[model samples]
Target: MGNTLKSVYDAKDNLKDYHVRAALQEDKGKGTTLMSWGLQDFTEKGDHYISVISGLVVRYGKGNSQIDETYIVKLSAPQVTKALRDMVAQGNKKEILFYRELLPAMNSELKKVGLNPLLTPQCLYANQDSENSVLILRDLCSRNFRKFPGKSCLDISHTRLILQELARFHSSSLLLKAAQGPQFVAKYDFLDKEWYNVTEDAIAFFITLFDGNIENGVAILKVLEGDKRTIRWLQTIKHNVYKILEEMMKERHSLHHCVARGLSGYDEYGNPIEAILLDFQIVRRASLVTDLHLLLNISVSGTDRKNNLENFLQLYYSSFKQVFDAAGLQVPFQFHELFQEYENKIMFGTLWALAVIPMIVSGGEPSEWASSHHRAASEEATGKQRESIDSKISSKHGELRARFLPIFDELIDQGIIH
Candidate 1:
């Protein structure tokens, strides 16, 4: 394993083969050689607050013909807190494990069953160094894959592609486990831990952040002139958040994967045709239902989620079952059981609305949660007021209100919160 980026590339025969082929297109037998390579920043400010991204651009040529290729390098941000930097390092290492070990093994199982491999960018290079960890990957953006816009609600077509991708990822785990027994996944034991290792210090931080969001939600509800009953229900939900979160994070189901965030490709008419899930930093072995709740509650618009959640579940299950059917294996659970699981997980949805939606609607960078004010707030016990939190929601009350009103209405209508 090479530590330097250039050494990694130089060691890759296939990469050289690719450049050699491209260079040879100009002249059938002319000699080809690598010319030069350089590095450049790859992401804009706020695109990724926890990690730094850059491109390693390589130029290779043969006799008047040249090709430039770029690979992305992701490293932990040096400027963040030690706690966050540690989490980032853990996530980067986990992702390296996903691409370098997990995905390849999972894809091999899928290949054995004659299914197409799960869609993911290729890992060109990876190192798991605790502080200076890095990954060099084939740049998905070069292939027209783009991050799904975070602020807007995703429509059904976009949502459909995402669910399909999720099904494939989850089913891959199932097929591999079935083929090799449950002990197979036990090797990657880190997937079974909670995403955040909740130490005593971390517990206080998580609860305070949870409370800050709960308070922000209460303010958003009041600003919307929300019904008193609904406001009270949100307050009650606040109290039970940590307990419910603990429950939700438990490993109740065997086939779990990362929370799927869309990195979509569009056709000429500008409609979504493909989705590739990204960000395996928090991959866990919890119920797949939580993935559903997280995506639908946070990523999809409240109206879209309300209108199509059942349809979305059916679509996901069918895609999931189709993989098993094609592989000549039994699906672990029936659709009715899946539906029940979704119903049982609505509390997760409510929690997402309270704790995660503000950041989405307020359009605040996730790094803001690390600000001095919020950090102070996170240290306090639950129920303490954080003016910074209130100001954030107050500044964006209209967007926050619009986003939450329908979500809360749907939750209340289903009798999940009240």
Candidate 2:
């Protein structure tokens, strides 16, 4: 075990103590001893922060009658820069609150509607302090739950499963808001401004990096540079994006409001099991379209999205309606209305793509990439990073152009760009 693992295991906190006892209780053994442990850093590429996942093998009984059991532990990155640390701290706060408060309330609502609770992994222990956070969750892998390949896009079937689950997740919020009113909603409102912090930075990055690639890239840059109206709109959006998100959250009828998991497996019929939602670090009340755009953009391929976008949106709305009807709630919008909202809100996906697609293509660690921008005052370093990122984008040019050009074209057609 490393220093971080040693500290976590030796900590005297109630949460850690409870987890050790709970693990033993689940084994149904009289006594348990830590046999051995292994830690793996499973943080993805381009992740600005680190997540250390550990597996502990425990032994019960002695000699020939021993049984071994495993438990999973999650801990914050032991090392990170100050900027990254602050961002991680913010995300940690949201995730801890989700597990501690929001999830239980949502589960209660699900039960009220005679539905199974949300399908999150069972958390054995959760703790967050000023500088560090930890969560001990049941190892889903032990139950044969796997993850979808990160580099690939979801096919139609998997996409449907994800959308269905997302609809259910969003419905929980609707049910909660309807039953408990704004006060209940208010409790989870700590970081509605989360997106504001990223939007300007992302837009700046997009403009700086994407100026010469796409057909209309230069034109869009010109507008952003010279058009007072466009600049003002950007400023307005920066100032008020959180307020817009809050309003979207408050809306009852739209599937366009609101918001992942990796464990994958096959069911009795041999179909792939639905992926569970994980990571509530950035969860917020928002337009149903927020989640929809994210899913379509990130998970579905460009060609697939172009071909099946409307069908998927319709499918999502239908699923959303089914949940609302089952819960004895009214569906608020017609399919056409929802489709229009999707078109209007599709820019969210474009904005996200501006930041993420580059990273996806670059395949570079975020900390290294981010260091360049952090020192943006140095034109020499910034130019090198730009060239490196540009090369990566060129490598994946065909796929990205297919994925993003249509979105840009649509925006231009809609007069979102001049």
CA error at residue 240 for candidate 1, angstroms = 4.1
lDDT by residue (tens digit), candidate 1, 1-418: 0011222232232233343334333333446566776556634334454455566676767678887777666665553444454555566667777777678878998898788888876666666654555666676777677777766677789889989888888888877667777677687776765434534444554565576567666766776688777788867766567887888767556545555344788777777788987667776677888888888887777778877878999999999988988889888899999988887777777776676666666555554433422255343522244445566666776666556777778767887656
Per-model clash counts, in order, read: 0, 12
Candidate 1 positional error at 156, Å: 1.3
Q: In model 2, where do residues sit more than 4 Å from their true spots?
A: 1-35, 40-50, 53-65, 191-261, 268-270
Candidate 1 ranges beyond 4 A from true positions: 1-46, 53-56, 60-66, 237-240, 255-260, 369-374, 377-398
TM-score of each: 0.82, 0.76
What global local distance difference test value does model 1 have?
0.66
lDDT by candidate, in order shown = 0.66, 0.58
After aligning candidate 1 to the native by TM-score, how far in Å is the CA of 193 from where it should be?
2.8
